[model samples]
Target: MTVRVGLTGGIASGKSSVSSILAELGAVVIDADALAREVVAKGTPGLDAVVAEFGDDVLGPDGELDRPAMGALVFADPGARRRLEAIIHPLVHRRSAELEAEAAPDAVVVHDIPLLAEVGRAGSFDAVVVVDAPVEVQVDRMERERGWSRAEAEARIAAQASRADRLALATYVVDNTGTLDDLRRRVTEVHAELAARA
Candidate 1:
């Protein structure tokens, strides 16, 4: 059977790194963020819907979605964010399900969803893996690694469910509070366990 692993975490929590390790170990990694962008590309139905609702202000001069402008509008207004999610979430869900169905028997398909906690899709998977760190560490990593301001980082964090909530849904937890090597070790361990299970 295909093992659908929902991998999630807060911003800057190293989910991508861990997802990469899982991919190296033969897991088919489906990244929701990448799909989110794809579904809204210039000619997609999702983008048409977004343009119909949000107007042309969200479009860049090149006719592509202005992601930063869209992000600002959503984060500043909950209703707008929900509207955006309404347009994008279904597309992500459909594509992810398709990928899951295509995976081999005994395949470990890892879905890296950044907002898995907020989106409430953790239970859709065979296993939920949460990558986490202390609040201070998360903020620091966001600011230093992502160049987000402290307030911006905090706002993003606040928009999602708390770390405790994420852990409550997790079947496995990877604490990313240290060096990359430490994170790699954890990923390797999880990979081995997943391989054995397969």
Candidate 2:
């Protein structure tokens, strides 16, 4: 009877911020990004597969995955990106499922998945909550808050599934174009709705 809610948003759209608020309201937040990192940590099976496919150069001097170096290799190469996803996606999903199973039956479990739209996982959740903001707002946040150059911000935003597509899958949409207080209010409202549903 747990409510498996998928929470997603575009880059810098305050998705993680909303997820934090949801967690504060007693939802069990299982982060896909965090799980992805864990499954590929220095000695995991995931890292072994990555090393076999991308070579040892992708590893840092301390033997951890050199994330920047790996990003450089895969970001520009579609085949390389697919290979990496092939290795990591299943591992991430399996770990997420295990975590979800540990939640209380009546818990409102929120899975923070950045690529929910692109990965076609919306239907797997009881409800999809989209933390949305105008693309221009996201671009500004990237530049001012994250110190990204305009070009870099635009490129990163373009890399994700489109905002339209993300919203299309949203059972609840929290627009995050304003202040932190405004965003939190929206998240609290959504959390209440989710809790009731659970």
Candidate 3:
């Protein structure tokens, strides 16, 4: 039995850190963001599909997808965002399935999905682990680490599912407001539970 865990959290809330720890603990981690980029890389059909839907101007001089340029268009327009998802989501799913298939039986497989709640997909996993921090903690990290302006950080946070919503589906919640050692301890505890389940 493979224990499929979906790990998600607000932007800058430390999902990546937890995912890294889980990987180090022998979980087969499938990263959605990495696969999203891979699907849209210079030579893939995902990039070509984007060019077909949005036109060549979304590409940079070197012919790669100019992400920020395209982000500007999609983030500001709901229809455009959906169209882009229509192109990329299936490809991401297919690749993710392939990676999940490669994991051993009884291995704990974690899907690091930033938008699991926003996409209403928390129930698909055998368990969901939410890396939680207070909104202020999230905003502070976004500003201090990612250098996002206060408004930008707030906007990004607001765009996701509410904390209550995420927690409602969580099998494990790693509160990340404290020190690194504290967070690591919580992660290890959760990892042990997931491994036991497997």
Clashes of each: 0, 0, 0
Q: Which run of 10 residues does model 3 get worst, by summed lDDT?
A: 115-124
Model 2 collision count = 0
Q: What does candidate 2's lDDT look like per residue over 81-172, in tens digits? A: 99999999999999999999999999999999999999998999999999999999999999999899999999989889999999999999
Worst 10 residues of 2 by lDDT: 70-79
Off by over 4 Å in 1: none
Report the C-alpha lDDT of model 3 over 92-143, residue by residue, as the tens digit: 9999999999999999999999989988888899999999999999999989
Candidate 3 lDDT at 106 equals 98
- Clashing residue pairs, candidate 2? none
Query: Residue 41 lDDT in model 2?
Result: 100
* Poorly placed runs, candidate 3 (over 4 Å): none
Better of 1 and 2 by lDDT: 2
